[model samples]
Target: MHIVITGAGRGIGRTLADRYRAQGHSVTGTARDGSAEIILDVTKPDQQRAMASQLRDTAVDLLICNAGVYLDKSESIVGYPTEMWAQTFASNVTGVFLTVQALLPNLRKAKGKIAILSSQMASHTRAPGGSYIYRSSKAAVLNLGRNLSTDLRHDGIAVGIYHPGWVQTDMGGPAAEITVDQAVDGLMARFKDLSLENTGCFDTFDGQAHAY
Candidate 1:
């Protein structure tokens, strides 16, 4: 399988890339710092186009839209700034969309699956207060994934939105419930089971259906 992963510099994205490569799959991992196979800042259109050009005519079996930011964490309602919201949405929502848009042709060639790493926080039922910017961005991406699933089904492509669990990563913190490896193990299983019949489904890393 030829897999493309964004934000592979660290955390769950990095781990996912490593595991896939270890399994002898062809992995195209991207990071903003140029440390991976591709240097892609998902919010940048030029970079997105450059990536598409690099992988042109190649069959991308899987595209993982994992580049995201969780700014505005612990911010009070009045403390949230406008710029924070803009940056968050750009990375978490618009970035995901642009990546999918740029790679549409490659995905079509392989009838690939798209795995969008959303969060349980994205659910309306999970709203418990702060991190408004992060929560809203995630929710928006979930909506984007669902809509993309519907449109891409005709192309024989599947899209699944996921909550990768409270992972022990820079974003999830040390106190988080699951280790990066644990989260990756579960996520890989979910990704493996993704198909047209389950497209647009919101699910947890462990395979449970998540609330929209």
Candidate 2:
């Protein structure tokens, strides 16, 4: 499998990249910094297209839209800074939207899988109030995944949304329950089990289905 993963400089993205490479797959990790195979800033459409063009003649078996950021402080829904809200959407929601759109042609050609990194907080059924920016952005991504699944189904592309759980990464913090390796391993296992029958379902790394 030739896998393209974003946000590969650190955290679950980096771990997943390493694990895939170890499994003898050709992996291209993208990040703003570090020794990424592709240098990409997803928030920038030109950079996203340039990166996609690099793979124009090739087939990508899996596209992992994993780049995201969590705002340091929580905001009230009514009182949130518009600038901060827009920035959050820029990376978390819009970035995923553009990255997938840019790569869809390649994915369609290969009949590949598209996985978006969402969060447990995206679950409407278990919605807890707080972390307005982060939560709302993740929820948007989850909804995007749902819509993409429908839009891309006829093209034979499988789209999914996954929550990596509370892994011990920079975003997850040191006190998180799982290690980066564990989370990525679980995610890989889930990815392996994906099929058209389960397309568009939001799930955790453990394969547990989540409510959208």
Candidate 3:
């Protein structure tokens, strides 16, 4: 499988890239810092275009939108700044849209699947206080993924939004609920089993349905 993963410089994205490569699959990992095969800041249209040009209609079996930011992790209700919201949304929301849009042609050529890495925080049922910016951005991505699933259905593409669990990563923190490997193992299964029959699902890494 030829996979394109954004934000593969570190954390879960990095681990996914490594694991996929270990399986002898072709992986095109992108990051803003030039730490991956493609240097793409997904929020930037020029960079997204550059990525498209580099791939040049190459058949992409899977596209994973994983680049995101959690800027309001510990912000107080009165302390959430306007800039933080804008920045977080840019990376977490707009970035996902642009990446999917730019890669649509490649996906179409391969009848591909898009796995959007949203969060459990995106679900209204599990809504807790705090992380306003991060939560809202994730929710937006989940919405985007759902709508994209509808629009792209005619193209034979499947789109699924995922909560990768409270993973032990830089974003999820060391005290989180699950290890990276555990999350990845489950997530890979989810991705592999994703099909048009189950498109637009807002689900967890461990193959469980999540309330949206």
Better of 2 and 3 by lDDT: 3
Off by over 4 Å in 1: none
True-structure RMSD, every candidate: 0.6, 1.5, 0.7
Off by over 4 Å in 2: 72-79
Best-performing candidate as measured by lDDT:
1
- C-alpha-based local distance difference test score of model 1: 0.95
Candidate 2, 100-186: lDDT as tens digits: 888888887889999999999888787678888888899999999999999988988888999999888877888899988888888
Q: What are the per-residue Cα lDDT tens digits for candidate 3 across 109-173? A: 99999999999899887776888889899989999999999999999999999999999999889
- Per-residue CA lDDT of candidate 1, range 1-212, in tens? 99999999999999999999999999999999998899999999999999999998999999999999998878887798999999999999999999999999999999999999999999998878888889999999999999999999999999999999999999999999999999999999999999999999999999999987
The lDDT values for all models are 0.95, 0.88, 0.94
TM-score of model 3 vs. true structure: 0.99
